[model samples]
Target chain A: MAVPTTRTARRGRPGYDLESLLRIAVKLFNERGYDGTSMEDLSRKLGITKSAIYHHVSSKQELLRLAVGRALDGLFAVVEEARTVPGRAIDQLEFLVRGSVTVLADRLPFVTLLLRVRGNTKVERDALAKRREFDHIVSALVEQAAIDGDIRADIDPATTARLLFGMVNSLVEWYRPRRDDDLHTIADTIATIAFEGIRLPGGE
Target chain B: MAVPTTRTARRGRPGYDLESLLRIAVKLFNERGYDGTSMEDLSRKLGITKSAIYHHVSSKQELLRLAVGRALDGLFAVVEEARTVPGRAIDQLEFLVRGSVTVLADRLPFVTLLLRVRGNTKVERDALAKRREFDHIVSALVEQAAIDGDIRADIDPATTARLLFGMVNSLVEWYRPRRDDDLHTIADTIATIAFEGIRLPGGE
Candidate 1:
C-alpha cells in the first residue's frame, strides 16, 4: 500500500490511496462499529470495488490493525522521544500529556476507534495489549513525578495517572476541532485544569 | 414489572425479580454490545427460558431503557435535591460532582452502559438526550462558579465542565468497588484533583 501523495488523479474517478482509504474506514468503523462494518460497506462508501480495497489492505482486520496501530505508534513515539532528552520527571509528564492531546486531535478518528476496541478478536486483543503497555509507561512517569516532589504526594501515582489520562482520553467523546480553537489552546487548557485545579489563584 | 423488595423468594429455584433480572441484563449488555445481545442470550446466561425473562422486561430495548433510566434518575435526583437549598455556585458544582461520583460507583454497570450508548435505536437516542441534559445542567453550574470567581476565569466554563466531568466519568472505566477504597475518599480524590489540580502546593 502506497501513501497518498496527491488529492486527485488525472482520471475523473475519485482517487484514494492507502492512507485515504484507511481514514474513511476508520470513520465508518467508529460510526457503525467495527463488527457492524464490512468490506462491502467500505466499498460502497468509498464508491470503489472491494477488489480495489483488497489491492491495498488484505482484509478488514488489516484495516483495523492499521488504524489502531497508527494511534498506538503515535503514543509510543511520544514516550520514546521523551526518553532521548533529559528533563525533570514532571516536565516529562507534562510533555507526554501535551503530546498525547496533539496526537489524539491529529488522529481523532483513529484514536477514537483504538479506544473503543473491545478485544473480541485476536487483532483487537493485540491492540489492547499494546494499549496496556503504553499505559504502564505513562504510569511510571507519574510515579517518578510524585517521587521527585513535582506533584502532590498524597494520591497513588498509578491512580493519578489514570485520572489524568482519563480526562484527556475523554476528548474523543466530545471534542471537535473548531476553526477558532487550535490544538495548542486545547492542550494548554487541559494541562492547566489537570495540574492547577480550576480554582482561582489564592481563592480556594 | 414489580421491583424486587425481598432478596429471596419461597421458590426452590432461587427466585429472581425485575431489578435482579435487569442487573444481569445490563452486565450481559456491557460484555456483549447491547445490539449484539438477544433475549435468548440473556435467558441462557440467566438459566431461564425466554418466556420467564418476558415476565419482567418486555424486550431487550426495555432492559436497556431500564438500565440507563436508573443512571439518569440518580443524576436528576442529585440536581433536583441541590435546588432545595441555596448555596454558592461552586458549592453546588462540588455537590454535583460528589453526588455524581457516588452515583457512578453505586450504579457502575448501568452508568457504563449509559455512557457507551451510540444512539443506534430510539432507546439509545433517548439516553443520549438525557446525558446531554445532564451535561447542560453541569455546564450551567460551572458557568456560575466562574462568575462567582471561585474558579479560574481564563478557561471557558463549558469546556471546563466537560473536562471536569470527563475526568469524573472515566471512573466507570477503571474504578471497582473495593474493601479498602470508600466512595467518599474516591469522590474527594476526584474533587481535589479536579478543583485543586494535582501539583504540589508551591510547585508548578
Candidate 2:
C-alpha cells in the first residue's frame, strides 16, 4: 500500500533535478550506508534507470559530495553569520552551539551522513577534514571563553569543546522534530542543559 | 611493515582464544564498518587463513555477537556491581556515568562497534535491543534522581540521560589512552564537567 502510494507520488512529480536526485540518494545512503549503496541501488529506489541517475550526478561519489557539502556549508555559514559574530567568546560559543542544533535539526539527514562518513574515499576524506576544521574553530572559541573566565577554567578547552559539541551532536542519534516541540525548543533545551548543568539555580 | 609485526606477535603467543579473536574482529569492524568488512578482509589483516579464522569463531556474525556481548556485559556488570548498589539516586547516577566512561575506555573497540550498529542484522538487532535496555535503566535512575531533588526538573529525565551518555560516548570519537591522562582522569573530568556546569560555581 505505502509502496504504491510512494510510486504514484514519484510518478506524479514532473521531473528529477539534481536537488531531488541528491535527496533520494542521501536517504538511500543513510539507510544502507554509503559503501553499501550503489548507483544501481539509487536507481532502483528512485524507480529510474542508472542513466537517469548519472544524468544528474556523474557518480555516486558526486551525490555524496553534494549532500555532505550542503551540510558542511550550512555549518560553516553558522560560524560566519553576522549574528554569530564574536561578542564575548562564551557568547559566540553559545551562539554556535545553538546554531548548530538548529542546523542539525533542519538538515538532519545530510548532517547524519556527514557525521557517519568513515574517510573511505576522497570525498569522505575531504568531509572529515572539513569537519575537523569546524571542530578546531569551535575549540578555539572554547579556549577564549575559558581565558575570559566566562566559563569554567579547570577543564581543558579542547576537551570541553568536544564534550559540549558531543552533547549537541548526539541529537542526530534520536532527535525527531515534531509539531508541538519544534526545532527552536529542541535547540534551546540543548543549550540550557549544556551550559547550565541540569541542576536548578541554588540547588545543591 | 606492521602486518608482519602483528602476525609475528600473534604467532609468538600460544593460545588463540575466542576473546582475542573478537578483539581483532571488533577492530576491523570499527575501521571498515561491520557491513563493509568481510571474513577475507579479517584474514588478510590477521595474516591468517579463512579456515584458521573460522576455527576460532564460526562466522563473522558470531564474532560480532561476542564482541558486542563483551561490551554489553561490561556495562551491565557496572550496573549490577556492589559498588553501584542502591544509594542516593544522584550518587548512583554519578557512579553509572563514571563507570560508563571507564567501560568505554577499557573496551573501546567493542563498545565503539556496539554504539555504531544500526540493527541491520540479527546480531546487530540484538545488540541494539540490549543497548535500549541499558539506556532505559539509566534513564530510570535519572528520573529517580530528579524526583529526589538531586538534579534539575526542567528537562525530561530520559532526554537528560541520553545527553549525559552522549557526552560520555563521544569520548570514543577522539580519546586516546595517553601516558599523562588515564581513564580515571578522563572519567573524573567528564563527571565534574557534567554535574557542575563548565561555568564556575559563582559565575553567570
Candidate 3:
C-alpha cells in the first residue's frame, strides 16, 4: 500500500515534501530504471541525504508501491466504470479502449513502469496481479461482444483482449504529449482504428 | 563498432572469445536488465574472472551494441524483403506484419531489449534510431496501402503503423516458443484480426 500522503499534514523538512519526493523518484526511476536506481541515487537527485529520504518514506519499494498503485487505480476505475455503462458490448469495448489510452497518456511514467516490470520484486508482482485482473474484465467484455453477434466468433475472446491491449500498451514506447496531438485525440484514434478493424463481418 | 568479432580471432586469450562473453552478457541483460545487472554479476554468471571479460570486450556498451545489432538486422530484413514481394500494398502490409511477429518470436531476447530500451545509454539510443528507421518503412507501406484503396483511407499512416506494431510488439509479453499453441495459427489469427476484424464488414 502507498504511504498515506493525504493524512500526513506535517513534515520534518517543509521544502522536501512527500509529493515532491515521489515526482523526483519517478523521474529518476524512468531515467535509470527501477532496479538501477538506489536510495542514495534518489537522495543525490533530490539534493538530500538518504536519511532525508527515509524521513519521507520507508524504502525504495514504497515509492514503487505508490507509483504503481496510482496506475492500477486509474485502470481499475476505467474498467469498473465501463461495466456500469449501458450499451452494446462493442460500444462498451470502445469506451473502455478510449478511456484506457487517455489514462495511459496522462500517467505515462507510472504506466510505463507498470508495463515494463518483470516480477522481480514484490511490488512488481503486485502490479502484475492487478494487470491480470484488468485483463480478465476486458476478456469478459470481448466475450459479450461476440455473443451479441457484433464481433466474429472465429477467434477466442481472450485472444481478442490480448490483441486490443497489445495496441494499447504500445503507447508507452512512443506516445509523447504534444500541443497538437493530445491524449483525447490519441485515445479516440486508437479506439476508432481498433473498432473499425475488428467489428465483425466483412466491410461494405 | 563491435571491435570486429571475427577480426580479433587471431589473438590468443582470444579477443574473439569476447563474442561468447557478449552472448552471455546479452542473455543476462535480457533476463535481469542492463541497469539491474552489473559486471560482477555477469562474471559470476559466466564463471569467468572479471579480467577475462575485459580481454574480449572493452565495456558493457559493446555487448549492448552487438545484441541490438542482431535485432535491427532481423527487423530491417523484414522491411527490405516485404518491399520486393509481388502484391498490392495491403497484401505487402499483411506480409510485413506477419513476418515482423515471426522475427520477433524467433529473436525474442534481442527484440525484447529493443522494445524495452528507454534510450538511457548510447547503445539504446542507436537501437531507438534504427527502430525509427524500421517504423518509417512500415509507415510508408501503410501509406501505399491507403493510396491503393485496399484498406480504409481515413486513418493516418503513422497511426496505422503504431497500431500494427502494437499488435506485433505485444507478442514479447505473452508469446512462448516450444509451446503447445501453434505459432502459424497465432500469426494467421493476428492477420485476420488486423485485416478483417471480428465483425464482418457491411458488404463482403
The best candidate in terms of TM-score: 2
Superior by lDDT: candidate 1 or candidate 2 = 1
Better of 2 and 3 by TM-score: 2
Candidate 3 ranges with C-alpha deviation above 4 Å: A1-14, A198-204, B1-20, B201-204
Candidate 3 lDDT tens digits, A107-169: 988898788777888988988999998888899988988778787777777777888899898
lDDT of 1 by residue, B1-204 (tens): 332333232335546699899999999988877877888788778776676777777788999999999999998999887766477888888889999898898999999999999998999999999998988988898888888889888887777788888888988878889746667777877888888887887665
Stretches of candidate 1 off by over 4 Å are: A1-16, A43-52, A84-86, A178-180, B1-16, B47-51, B84-86, B178-182
Ranking by lDDT: 1, 2, 3
Error of 1 at B46 (Å): 3.7
Q: Please compute and give the TM-score of the first chain of candidate 2 against the native first chain.
A: 0.89
Displacement of the residue B189 alpha carbon in candidate 2, Å: 2.5
Tens-digit lDDT track for model 3 on B100-178?
9889888888888778776878888989988888888888887877777677776778877888899888988988897
The model with the greatest DockQ is 1
Between prediction 2 and prediction 3, which has the larger DockQ? 2
**DockQ score for model 1, please?**
0.56
iRMSD in angstroms, per model? 1.6, 2.0, 4.3
lDDT agreement with native, every candidate = 0.84, 0.81, 0.78
- Give interface RMSD (Å), model 3: 4.3
Q: Could you list the CA RMSD of all candidates, in the order they appear?
A: 5.8, 6.0, 5.5
Question: What DockQ do the predictions score, one after another?
Answer: 0.56, 0.45, 0.41
TM-score of each: 0.87, 0.87, 0.87
